[model samples]
Target: MPLHPFHGRALARAIACAIASASLGAHAEDDPQRATTLREVRVSAASHDTSVDPDLPSVVETVSAARLDRLNVVNVEDALKYLPSFGIRKRFIGDENATFSVRGTSNQQSARGLVYLDGLLLSNLLGNNWANPPRWSMAFPENLARVDVIYGAYSALYPGNAIGATVLMTTRMPDRLEVTGEVQAFTQHVHDYGVDRDYGGSRQSATIGDRSGRFAFLIGVSHLRSNGQPLVYATQALSSATGGPRPVTGAIADTGANGLPRQVVGINAEGQEATDQDEAHARLTYDITPDVTAGLTVGYWSQDMSHRTETFLRDANGQPVYAGPVTIDGRRYTLPANYFAPSTRQSRNYLYGASLGTHRDTGWNVEGNVSYFDMDRNRDRVASSVSYNGAGLLTAGDGSRWRTLDLRASHTPDSIAPDTHTVSFGYHYDGYRLANASYNLDAWRRGGAGMLTAANGGSTQTQALYLQDAWQLVDGWRLTVGARYEQWRAFDGSRATATAGVRYAERKETHTSPKASLAWTVSDTVLLRLSAARAYRFPTVNELFQGSFNGIALVNNDPRLKPENDLSRELSAEWYRPNGVARFTVYRSDTRDTLFSQTDTTVFPNVTNVQNVGLVRTRGAEASYDARDVIWPGFDLTANAAYTQATTVRNRRNPASEGKQFYRIPRWRANLVATWRATGRMALTLAGRYSGRQYNTLDHSDIHPDTFGGASDFLTFDARVTWKASDHVDLGAGVDNLTDRRYYVYYPYPSRTYLVEAKFHL
Candidate 1:
């Protein structure tokens, strides 16, 4: 559907009028002497790390605790599902590989976005894949006060990672004694090819905090466990003649869009992944003076997972030949019953941070923060493909570590001139270290020892300086201008292959980014904004140094990969009333040297590596409407829709890929939520989410339906009800994907799921 230029204005006026009329008529006759206020003003100071004011031209959205609790989400990522132009690729309830996408960006491009907790970076930034996602498990949901999502990288304090969007989570420090606990249980009914069963999960969390004099402390803990469905399916190529040693049970022929016939040999190759997670966090703060505060925080997280698969292809005596030669169509074929590869993984992480800051009523304020994250342990053991019942291979993992330091100061001069300025300057330093190794095990299923096969390690450091000024040119006009200079270096980078000894290299580069935004308060109830920026994202160590060997044929990585540079622009309009807000924004971005994992298929066996894709472009528009009380009391609604066209503008390396849509990004997305408070203690909410068609491959050839790697358009409905039984107790029940819509992100997504929860507050 095409958007009319006047739709924004019409929708805004309709919402404002409805809210004003409802508020005035709600028991207003009883108080005729009281005056009505249709508009409310909200003022907030600029955030030091983001360097953005609430009233700035940039687009920013905040989700409050009340709204978050009503959603009854399982994690921080789940809470953001309903936001405009935002999507989370959560395959299952407790999927650690879950990632997010914003606007034109895909989940695989993790470096395009940024995630932060308490002004500290949480995005892994180690590699752009599912295994390397933001450390969202670090913060317990009970400890979060609010979450802020800033659109675009139109801020000097942030790096190019913010080119997509920036998510900032703020934790709360109770001013008084407080205690909270919650327990939740959920189950999903799944139905798919060779997979039809029920998966269950549960979570438990608790938090306690207290404040006395100038000292405050808070602590929280959470545990989660879940059984996920199959991760992959087993299949075999179809043959013209049927002579395959008597077909096995449950073997069915299928044809895909590519006009090829295949037989499904069995159910899920890696079946039912069971995972357990435990996490804890603590925060301590002390007031050194009336306006100065010092704080420290520590966080720990760990997970253990194991899974096994079953093969339906049996042999002559009812014995399963995990791997052997089979006669198919009179042609001898080496079929592997061990195609179902099972594995186990164990991981642990720790985080520590300290901050000192002083907030003043006027003049200048300064804040400094230092933090570190340690990937203490990460190991994976896989069953050998050659022999499933025999020994396996162990990838003894050596993980990564990162540290950051930020020092910033902001000043608001005590001037009475017609114009006012809020100046901000900051210095940032970030360091990352990564180590990975692979080993060969004698027996993985039985916990056998292993010998090292290949190992490599690397480190990166970045230093940056930025300055920004938010100038209020007049009563209703403002302009924000900023610039940032960053120096990035990769040192001690090396790769060790089984055949080759080792290769090491070091690289360095510098870039400068500039941003500018203008805002105009068109009227008491309407506003307009325009913003633009130029940003660059440096290549990651894995993208530059990691290489894979296919049967001793080395597929080399590009150490001289150029940084991704983006030029972005946005125009937005907003209308606000006391009870509602409506907004519309149109944005465009052109990026060069986009990093992509591609295959140079010209060789006998395809070689894969991260390379620079020439140029890409995206254009999109977003419209949103939110209201607390539209036409009736105790009722609220939120609705949003987004349309995006992200495509490759130029690709010299592969001419066929040009003009194709980006992978895994939908052309249209929308969400709707309606909540009704039946009484003072009871409330119900109904919501629906819709994602349009998208491709899983760069050439847009994934047209198969209900098949893995062929993602199709999907829509789902959800409903929740909450009952406040008492002042300190609450009970809730909800259903997600109520219609049981089957979907896939390469891996089949969850089906109709039900959840029940109970919480207590003191």
Candidate 2:
């Protein structure tokens, strides 16, 4: 193997760092910019023009931990709320089911995007829905160094899931002994139909780490407790007769068209649920040689939550109504106060992984990482009926695991070709398995073997090979091209019940994804890039085998769902200066066989299942401006705007949805933030975000904006201030949704929330 011109320089730098750290009784760490700087020099050496690769053909953005701290983020989702064309449906603080959306990707399609923590996959690919969102809680904000958001599937290094977006989070590795602790308290004031009160929460965390010689170790733990507002609303049809056997709850004037008595604006029967969560994580790293490193990591998370509700309706005797009807002035009414069922849920999750990697400036560099996640415990119990009868357990036992292997080789020719070139080739393998089961129960108070309601699972495996090359064709032009071939298979697909058993046949698919880009240096301060790509995303285990159960074969597990394919193109331009940068991108995507879950109530009987649409198209543009020390020595500002129009073009299976906008995707959004360093020990920041109205159904039939059922436009404000109280102590306070903007994304979002936090470090 031959070596590049900068190979010797990179080696000398690495050796120098190693020797310096060894003599100081420490472990060597890679320089943050070493890789980028070296790659730039090598690319320009052939053209005899030395210029940095400041702007790649692809659109990528990075958010550093320092910026997160300045914003006083509350969680991993909060830290990413300001990214361009990106959003997360976070109903409340400590929400377990937070789902993210980027560009044209909707939140309901959880599998369209990918997330990684230090090269370990955190995305839950077993299913594609709100419940199967990435394990964001497993990634602690305090442990993160930075997060990179890759906008498109323009690289062979990632799978087709990157067609929507790829989020990579890198954690901090301690160079020396360190200890940190934090305490936080928060509260929100809610004012909906029946809910007019304050709910609160608290969190505490600690971390410790050290690096000595050739080994390093770190451990972190966190605990949180919260009382959240109701997630479900009670409703009744306006067309229903007033007289009924069931009791009635106090009614409120209807807001939608078919006006009828809906449940009064108040907490639902389940009321507020109190939640308790705990997380623990540890990692150990060792240097096997001067150029090789090995590491192991383990993480565990658990939750205990329970809640009970009280009805507002009462009988003649003033007792809270539980059942039966009542008459007033010869008028009869049906009340459902008796059907309020409270519930409790307990679950525990675990994650473990191991990795080995090598680094070298010249020749080949390779890395391998494998991870497994298990659902240790999952059980939910609910009241059998509205009479406060015995409780019944809903046996939902499910688990999934993914194993990934990657190997790569890259080298830059010592003797330059016609143009400077760096070539890379890699092989990848990933296997995923899901086991799901559910059971019916007779008595809620006691646990016993009940009839099996559902039992099904499936597995998906993929093997892929890819080759990529980057060439600087001339002094001011560069091109990158890559292609990947993947073979995918779904096996062990089955569905069964205690009385009847149904099985599905195995499925297979194959695709070739190609990517290309051309970048031109327009001038010393401007750069322009145009790119295009073709990608495919396969169905998950749940999408292929998880079926709804009824008396008949409605929504039978169809084993022949086709993979989704997308053709995308983008044009981007960036202007750079000493103090700030501005960037704009316009992109479009045309997708075929798009997978989505649909409600088919008119199919003789109601049935909900996942289906594929013929074609869908999306066009969008994003612009952002970032500056530091804008008007003062310590002032920073960032502003961004996004517009996207995602619509179904053709769908033979559901023609009514054609020409309608995609669900839960706002067409317009804007975000702005400003930060000021008031003093050496103090900082203050303020932010604002706005989102336009969006649809909740494929046909866009939901026109009314009710607090509980429809998506509504909203704008919110946030502010935070932090002060260094001492050398080892810090204090901070912040307010989210400062304007108390009332909005809904099918569920009421939090309003006017405040938090206070304190931190100690050594």
Candidate 3:
């Protein structure tokens, strides 16, 4: 295949950056010229990238505890900030609405990925957008032992949500005794059109764990207080506004994402957030004999958040204008009542999990775990308008929860033929329910629920069974095959308005998917692998039942939606030495009945709803290189680049998007990190991240992505230094967005930020 000129240029730039990164090192290690075996590769790989499961066919990218401590990790999600071919949509330090992006998956598609913390499911799969981000707050950075990311749905042990990837987070339990404490502070300067100031935050955490005889216990807690930059802008299409004599100043003239005349009036209340969040976690583990163990984990998280807005427009008297019609350069623009309305929110959540497992080196191994997430108290209060802080609306989510259960068994028998085989099977179950309602409030700050205004809620459940076998066919040859059968059902769905409500009929579906992979060792330093899999992602509850009633008729949703069927393929080649490992991979995904919220243009009325598209296609290539002592001893480098071309293939309902790029998926991305160990106790590091321009719409009409509401291209640099003052204390400092370049991913990305931290260990 030949690359187009546009993509060719990007590839060239990536190669140039790679060269620049390699040139930073001065001394290269001379590895011994010896024949290596598969055992050597497995050991070396596991030492660096600890594996959650060694039998997984796909390459697992991981960040170990040692690596995590060396980096400037503000939150648990930061540990995955620089992984190969990965993107995280964490808008700020205390952002709860954060999601992950991988090959062929957009950042907003949360259902395409799955996250697990110590065998507990953290992904809120009720929806696939901002509100459904994984519950990273449940586990703090101080307690994370390791995090592993597996790309593509090539394993039978996981469900269809693993199509994009699967994240497995393991928190450590002390064997003897351990104590750790950390404090972090960061500040970032912002200079957007109307907002210009410095925002900062601070965090503190502590963890203590110890083991006595056959029992071990660990406990950790963290608290964060942060203020973030404005996320939503109050803008008007000047071309459509009327001219008036009442004049106003301070509005900035600009072009909208659609390349149209626009005027920025002020900021919205969505992202100008000041947040205080707290999390506490505890775990207990007991050994029942030598090969059997039981464990329990409990977690709690609380959040107090407030949103504030500011206006740029001012009248002749120099008084601020937050709402109503305002004239800017003789063009009159009307700001809606909610344009600058302030709001506040509070939430308390709990998680409980338990597990029992038996481990033996030669016979059958069994493992079972169960987890539940409870939304104890969740409420949000919003002012009615800019002038009215006394009365508004209150949205409460009281009975929302999710639970998961898994049971698995594996057998490793003696080799009976020319090849040896290891077989494993598992059963999985998950269910989710949400109950959200909005009511009128007499007082926005403190008031009782007056009257119910609207409600939308639903429930979804899934059960699955899978079996997989890993076989050593011959010398340097291996093959793995797996299959999964899943049954999904959506029930107890209801959507209501002020005057009417509707209950949807139950829906059920069953699907069986097949997975296979083949690996061959070409030489001592090289290995090649091919993988293919068919997976299905069922419709989420919110996608099927969350909608409004227009004159007693349902709108904006479709309960008759179908599941997405996906077929993915990948080819990977890896080369490893004692000092480093490198890989180059190409992958493709062809999905049928892809889900998207669009209008059905084939009909005369052009009804718009959450519907299924005919097909979508994506193809990409990725190259990752990690080396120590690249060109010089004591120097290390990690770099990766990816090119993805994702587009809508068949969408008769919305023909304009049939051949356009997928929303929110960038075309090119790259990351590079270089570290220099100045001494035995000090280290200095530099990192850079780049993401190509992307559109926020399906029709590719938003060519101007640099605006306030656009997904734009950005390249950022970061630096960090670490010094071990003693055997039990570590100090670190870092700065992100070193140049303070302004960019937007719908919400402005972080500007130049300074971070400092101190860690005490015992």
lDDT of model 2 at position 87: 80
Per-residue lDDT value at 327 in model 2: 40
Q: Candidate 3 lDDT, tens digit per residue, 1-762?
A: 111123434653765567556645424654442222342123223221222556677867767686776777888889888887788898888998889888778887899999998789999898877788888899878787778888988999999999899988887778779999999999998887867799989999999999999899999999999998888887888755568756889988889888897888788769498899999999998889888888899999999999888888888999988777777886667778778889999999999999988766546888899999999888999999874458899999887999999999888665423388878899999999989899998888888998999998999999999999988888778888999999999999998878999898999999999999998888887888889999999999888988777788777898899998999999988886666667888999998888777778778777877788888899998888777777777777888888889889998888899888788888888888888888999999999877777888888888787778788777777899999999999999999888777778888877888999999989
Determine which window of 10 residues in candidate 2 has minimal summed lDDT: 42-51
Ranked by TM-score from best down, the candidates are: 3, 1, 2
Per-residue lDDT of model 1, residues 229-279, tens digit only = 776666676755545554344455676534467765554444668899999
RMSD of each: 4.8, 10.3, 3.7
Residue 33 accuracy (lDDT) in model 3: 29
lDDT agreement of model 1 with the native: 0.77
Query: For each candidate, what is the lDDT?
Result: 0.77, 0.73, 0.83
Q: For candidate 2, lDDT tens digit of each residue in 165-213?
A: 8887766778899899999999987767666789989999999999999
Q: For candidate 2, report its TM-score.
A: 0.89
Alpha-carbon runs more than 4 Å astray in model 2 = 1-57, 243-249, 256-261, 265-271, 307-310, 322-338, 361-363, 387-391, 412-418, 442-449, 552-556, 600-607
The better candidate by TM-score, 1 or 3, is 3
Indicate which candidate wins on lDDT: 3
